[model samples]
Target: MNDPKLTPQALWHCALGLLSRRDHSRLELSQKLRQRQFDVELIEQALDKLEQQQWLSDHRFAVVQVRQHIFKKHGPLRIRMELKRKGVNEAYIEQALAEEDPDWFELALVCYQSRFRNRDIPDIKEKAKRMRYLQSRGFNSDQIRYALEAEQD
Candidate 1:
């Protein structure tokens, strides 16, 4: 690692290279640069440059993150909190989440069925277990309940 005191440009280049490989939230990119001992001011400048060039965008980050995380079987609540932790703005998160259709509950149920196929547990116990699993994945209580009941029907 170049000395933080002497190589701001090198640090920026390195960070940009890393970022070019994937989308990174501001906080995430900051933490990565910090681990290399880059000065905070220098890191911020690099990040600002990237943003000005449109190479870094929180809006794009939020959209891609939500899409990718949901595809991995994560629930919306979990995805939302994770995006917040990654430093995505609240307004963007809310807007993206709002645009998502409410019919996702049925999709979630389908996912659960696919994953747990071929095993038949008793209804009450099964619903409880399913609820816990979905809740841990970040679904709200209502969504989880609805999915569980729909499974029974």
Candidate 2:
């Protein structure tokens, strides 16, 4: 599918078509164009125009990704890492998370309850396991502590 004759207009339309499906970080769009064997210079030119037109923004992408991850019950750490992997700016990621202002402890509790639903953690080993589970899901130690204690109380 490599077409050496592909032009800038063609690349622009292709990029826009991809974005119409969903928001994409600049890096993600670039990689997709690269996969299609589009000329790197043409891809960059299209991206610059899109960004200039405010049609492709890392900020918007970060916000959308954050909301989606939150809906899936993921914690901030995981979401942040994923956005960073997608090449979103750290400032934008932080801004998006701040704007959401989610209750991390509550989310952690919900996540834990979904898995263990009122089941008492009978021993240190089991409690540690639950804490570790929440941590793996991206909740911080503080939030995990609150979830464990809040449920047992």
Candidate 3:
């Protein structure tokens, strides 16, 4: 419904309501507005206004998300994938990943200790389990092995 009567003000209000709760990519906002049947032009106008005011920023979103993900022990690969899914630009994702410096080995060891504190297993089984766990959390094999080796030391 590209109703000219559907004012930009209404769309802006709706968009602000959504943004107030959490960060969203422009693509995500566009899709939501489309489902609401707002006029495409009106929605785009509102989005442009928001961007002009710095209320809608893909770079800021990427930075915040990457920081939080790393803090929660997520690896760069997983964080990058998530940012891409959220429609962040490739250059922004690359910059954000480069800016983040996490101690994967330490974090992985901590995670391993937390998950298998009292458990005992053979070296092979333990390594396998650790590999699976870290990999599932989006860590590369190298990081996982380093962490596991650190645990063994």
Candidate 4:
């Protein structure tokens, strides 16, 4: 249970402990603090202090998340959705994505080839299945089509 006498310093220390483990967007930190039964005003004050001290930033979190997702070979669509879910704003998401200039089409091709290199594409059904797999991996329709066509060439 939350003590009615919980001080702002206590709440800030709790927030710092969470931040020490991993980066968190402001909203995510607020939600976690709230779950611990901290008062809303106290949580806001703690978050403001963290932001002021430059120890918390949604922009930094988005950048790190985007890089990690790209390394995992997840596509832009999936990455964007994940960032949105993490309470990152559109500006930060776009800025983070813009900083990385990978060729998505080629990336999609590489991802497809890596997964389907040994398989035989024998029929329309099989090709369609492969296309669906690529789509599920977050490649856009153009990127999927290009990757499939590249396989035929």
Top candidate by lDDT: 2
**Rank by TM-score (best first):** 2, 4, 1, 3
Residue 16 CA displacement from its true place in model 2, Å = 1.0
List TM-score per model, in order. Answer: 0.88, 0.92, 0.85, 0.90
State the displacement of the C-alpha of residue 21, model 4, in Å, after optimal TM-score superposition. Answer: 1.4
Q: For each candidate, C-alpha RMSD in Å?
A: 2.3, 1.8, 2.4, 1.9
Model 1 global lDDT (CA atoms, 0 to 1) = 0.79
Most TM-score-accurate candidate:
2
Candidate 4: regions farther than 4 A off: 1-6
Write model 3 residue lDDT over 7-117, tens digit each, in one string.
676788889988998888887888888887888888888889888999998888888898988778887778888988888999988887777766776776676677777
Model 3, runs deviating above 4 Å = 1-6, 123-126
lDDT value for model 2: 0.91
- The TM-score obtained by model 3 is 0.85
RMSD of 4: 1.9
Per-residue lDDT over 75-114 for candidate 4, one digit per residue giving the tens place of the 0 to 100 score: 8888899999989999999999999867889988898888
